[model samples]
Target chain A: MSITKRIIPCLDVDNGRVVKGVKFVDIKDAGDPVEVAKRYNDQGADEITFLDITASSSNRKTILNVVEDVASQVFIPLTVGGGISSVKDIRALLNSGADKITINTAAIKNPDLISEASNAVGNQCIVVAIDAKRKANSPNGISWEIYTHGGRNSTGIDALEWAQNMELRGAGELLVTSMDKDGTKQGFDLELMKAINDKVNIPTIASGGVGTLEDLYDGIEKGKADAVLAASIFHFGTYSIKEAKEYLSKKGINVRNTYD
Target chain B: MNIIAIIDYGMSNLSSVEKATKYVAPNDSVVVTSSPREIDNADKVIFPGQGAAKNCMESIYDKNLDKIIKKNSKEKPFLGICMGMQVLMSYSEENSGTNCLDIFEGKVKKFKTRKDTKIKIPHMGWNKVSKKNDHPIWYKIKDESYFYFVHSYFIDPIDKSTVIGETKYGDIFSSVIARDNIVAIQGHPEKSSDTGLQFLKNFIGI
Candidate 1:
């Protein structure tokens, strides 16, 4: 059996600074991305995801230097996403020591990109990211639509179906974020997450709406997600990785127990 | 001088183990070496491993550390971790044809669970270890102290008396096994926190 229940800390990098906000509002620069990533790595984060939120729109270099700087400091896996569209971009990220590359809007624009990227990099190195928002009026009744362009554009593509297709295209994992619940701190969208997880055999990492430790637990236990990704709670030091892991261990969630 | 020689068998997280040993046994000498001679001369030996069990055993054999480890076990303190602990068993069902160190008369078997259960494989993360006997290795640790574990196969001790600790997944399994001077833990003591650190300290004293 593969290793499951990963505790990930998402770094939303803007202008090379780590920033996070509630509901994507009042975005505040957290700290240096390398420094913050080092802190999480020292604290025992299972994996680190660096999402360059500004890379796509600004066309700025995805901070390969910063990725290299952080990767050199830690031994755990590092994943980079945002503005990663082509196989070349994936190559650049991998060359910089990124263990995985997450493709979001590019995957939505050209579904075949998944197959191309997977063919170039191993399937284990390619991750498909789905930014989903709940829709009430779909024919299926309460459907999840794919949002692209950094959650600015909504493509009517059903998230559940897209996830299944991406897996078939050889995506090793799926990073699913609920647009409605992102940065809300309320919790993860369990219904939408379960919808995708039930259909795909690959690992699904639930993103957005993580306010507290309970919210993360819900994403793993109730949402049935293989991993839970959070930003604000971890960014502000509201909860340490050790604390969250201890809480999960007490709940019988099979978390890495480092505590005495 | 209580020199702690951590076996460097090309496994993951060896640095972390060295760091943790340093943290616990600050004044004592802690060195990670693949040399069997160094291991033989060390006051204590720690066998830490990750990745596959068969691969780990092959590494020990390739480096000719098997005889050294077996010989040292009779005279020095030893601790095996994760796949390290699994490899101490007689054989593993992992590769089907590979034989383990056979130090302990037991087989490393895969976790048996029902299909409908939500339990995932590779049982990653922290869990509590129930004491089978109040061994000195667990000194300063409570009855059910939590320790970090990441593996799929577990040792089924043929000599239950050697089992020092047990942890429950879907079922209760051997977490730590000790026979005479050889003490092997299935969890990563370096990654594991205070209790794990204290356990390492106690092993050093032994």
Candidate 2:
């Protein structure tokens, strides 16, 4: 009836291998990016995000190889994050078959990177990934502050204001991860998601800390995110993308039916 | 089994489309190029693009692909996608109103945005597209099947008969248009998973 909220499966990659436990059967290699991605694709994942956790620059090729492998077989949008600093890096990833590239610390270091990259390649391919951590107490009515280096450091940037600025810089989408809720399984930072969604017109992907399928549904319902990204739930085979969509669809969330 | 040319007017990342097309039709020669000669010689031509309408049109002109596109749409099987589909319209309100290729008498209008409604701009995500008028592209694709869509604007064709498919955000809008040898889809079939792959397969077959 209307646009279905996207359900994206996040794959954490290190040295070209999927680092998380993908409990899907028939997967010959646990670390093979293609195998894991193909499994997600078969399960009806709307899109796949590959985050290279490796800080080693040499291992960058491994991620590129992984991207090329999955992209050749996976007939869905592919988003790559981590180490996307320069325009050349973005070009390389896109050439290697990434549909979109996410820039985080680099963009914060140089805000112009968002503008330059979006100008070079359409904004649709440039996603500004923001890791937000709640700033204890604020008199200014601020909810979250941006974090960097995998949530290891804080940038002291207001999440909402930065979101608006990124949108102004022509970011196609925002992938906001709540450091507070992430890995806690407590659910997404709904307050942060809603704030970003309300401030910017571009699409926002709600991520970090999804313990249950109900959390994903609430992300769209309460957070009002255009898409939801989760790892442990889908990665561990605890739930499939099809199951997730069916759950959301049943809740009047308007999700795509994984299997037509 | 065929030489498929994906028209690259510098408006898109043509890899996904080219890869999807190649995955579906491995035997076919799928090349992403702005060269008019390649488009002219191909058995099937796919017009896939994204970005502003004005920029896309300007790129098409810069590449001198307008004549080839116009010629192929009439004589050969052609499938236009997203911005590609938009450019085929008579005009667009984007960029403070811009002129298009005018293959069909239509205008691309932006979706209304309000502070109160949950409806977001760009209409970004998968949505159900119902068949308005049946065609080969709908071969095995069921009516109201879900497809990927991510755009702020949509086309309004003057001739409703040409609108083969429709989707609703706040109101019903044309999602697919077809006339003669040309079919334009507002959604990205390449990124659309199985349903989209099937649609592209049908286009390749045609």
Candidate 3:
């Protein structure tokens, strides 16, 4: 049997509530994160990811509580990211019902965190998220640089090289987000996704800039992504998870039939 | 008492399994414990685990749960998940070769993918599993239904009769093995969707 392509609904949570924004700004409240997650679970979402966008030291406990709440209600694999810095943090999140922990900012600060966390926990549970933007003026025509702090700080690190290093450091999966296409409703950055997918042997998830059902298919067909994650389109009811899967199925892409 | 014991040898997230069990059988007591005595006292047992095989074996060895699990597997209905299923094999190729409980005659081999294979390791995400034989545990879950899977290694049961479900990832392998009173799956049914929960519900019913 063919492996089914995954369609993930991501919740950018802030202070125990789900939030949505356009291009990471002008944020607005969506609804109760737990209720929203349960709805997605019913809709046949392959998995759910919660990113604590405003994850601060004070709100860490709140996020953990939120994760616990979501885990108790929803049965799909839950991946949590944002403000996670150390193995202790990763452990806490995993214990609080997160199936996988995504590290981006802290991983940028200390690259060894990926190796260390993978060594402590199995690589299957560690996901290194890379927020990247296409750089046209770089030495090579095809290049992207890494961004940290919610896509604010620009680092000169090459996106492709960073992806390779993360794999070497024992990352089980990579959540590659194209900042340039994020929240634009334009579609995924297929070039950036193809660049990383060709370089890494691990499962890669294409995130950001998903507007239509066609974009979801392209992310897997053209970009060679193992999974696709989205926020606004799913959160605002622009499309249901069932509709997306049925559309993919009609397009000849293998998707898990929830109705069957 | 109809208590369902989910053995927690300090590996894996037992909460989801516990929640799924509770969701399916609200009246039954679902406890996550590493205590051998509790495992023996329970009416049914669910053995679940994750992480490296070496570490998992070490935990099962340290807790002295291997014998209890083996003894209970023959006495009552037992279900295993992911790493839980691997430890039942004779040996695993993870962490530079780790010996297992040898409950079943098989070995766990890593997914060796060539450059042209085009299949990613750790086979994470959803895949369709086809039933091999008729059994109570296969109740409502449709034939060749989709289930969530995440692993680099798949169990190779020496006795094909023990394999009740099969899935293909680069190569055909045993995804669910059942014989007598025990049933195990490589997929995480707790994380799978409604159909996955239905598997757990069927297990509890059996």
Candidate 4:
């Protein structure tokens, strides 16, 4: 009766190889992005997100080729992020059949790029990714601060204020990643997700720190995320998307439930 | 070979729709064009719109593709998606108030998100479409199948008979409508996985 919470499997592709984030035990040639994408898509993943971690321009072509190949075979929504800086890059991905593209650094450095890209492409296809870390010693006593350069640098910008600003500047959705719990295999920062959800009217995706199926449930239940994005749990073959969806469904959460 | 014209007013990104159509009906020639003549000669038309209804109407009027679209809907197996479906209505409450194509009698209004429910705007992601009537487009597809949706406003058609599928978000709203030769949906049949590809295949068959 209501909109189902989305389960997105994050693929960290580097120079066209599914290198570090995911570790599919069953599939042959696990490094291939196209093969891994098909595995997830067949398993009834609500959506697929590819983070192009390649550093060189020539190497970025590998990610683009991966998107094109998978896009032809996979019928669900595909989102690509990481190192997407300009409107041209956004258009290139969209033209290659990427349903949505997420931007993190560009969103903060050039805030106007959000509005420009939102106007160029519909806000529906534009996603603003926020990386936040809890403040250690707060003079003002705020909970978290937005980080840039993949949690390497501090912006001193409050996460809540940045989220609201992005929404006002025309971001359709917010992808909130907790830098503190990113790879810890701990649970998500429920307070951070809940706090961002309360401040923004747009859909917020809870990312980082997902250890088990229970973490996925808490992301929606207590964290209040519209969708849950996990990297290692899905990529490392800890739990299939179907099992995650089934667990969520059995707990009375509305998921697609179309997977047999 | 029948030609399928995917209407592009330069408002929405048409690559996925165009790609899906070409993939499903490879034998048929699919063209994404704003040319009125190309649209008129096509056997079927797919009208895909996004962003705002006001801008959609303005672009259509600017390029003079409105007349051709209106003519094609009545003469071919027409499909409208998202904002494409919204603009088929008589008027829309989006952008304060904007006139639509008036092909179908309805009013498009914004989603009223209640603060308590935490229901977000721009209803983005997949939801179920419950069938209300036996339309050919429902061929082989089960009732209440999930389809992809992304929009802020919902449509309220005057003629209830035209509504073929309904979906619930904050409230139940019309998701699919069928009348004459026109078949329009608020969801994207192109991006909804296997079921979606089947939908396009069925439309191509029609």
Candidate scoring better on lDDT of 1 and 2: 2
| Candidate 3 runs further than 4 Å off | A21-30
In angstroms, the error of model 1 at A54 is 11
Query: DockQ of candidates 1 onward, in order?
Result: 0.07, 0.69, 0.74, 0.74
Instruction: Give fnat (model 4).
Output: 0.69
Provide the overall lDDT of each model, using Cα atoms, as 2-decimal numbers.
Answer: 0.78, 0.89, 0.89, 0.90
Instruction: Write model 2 residue lDDT over A43-133, tens digit each, in one string.
Output: 8888999999987887778887888888889888899998878999998899888988999999999999999998888888889999999
Error of 3 at B8 (Å): 1.6
Q: Write the per-residue lDDT of candidate 2 for residues B161-187, one digit (tens) a residue.
A: 999999988778999999999999999
Q: Is candidate 1 or candidate 4 better by DockQ?
A: 4
Model 2 misplaced stretches (Cα beyond 4 Å): B115-118
- Residue A113 miss distance in model 4 (angstroms): 0.8
Put the candidates in TM-score order, highest first.
4, 2, 3, 1
- TM-score for each candidate, following the candidate numbering: 0.69, 0.96, 0.96, 0.97
Inter-residue clash pairs, candidate 2: none
TM-score of 3: 0.96
Instruction: Give the poorly placed runs of model 1, Cα more than 4 Å off.
Output: A1-176, A196-205, A212-221, A237-260, B115-117
Cα error, candidate 4, residue A50 (Å): 0.5
Clashing residue pairs, candidate 1? A23-A183, A255-B125, A255-B126, A256-B125, A256-B126, A257-B126, A258-B193
Against the true structure, whose TM-score is highest?
4
lDDT of 1 by residue, B1-206 (tens): 68889998765435556766776788999998999888988988988876666677787888888888788878878888877788888888987756988999988998765675545444655577889996889888887776766566788989999998999877788999998888899876664545677887888888
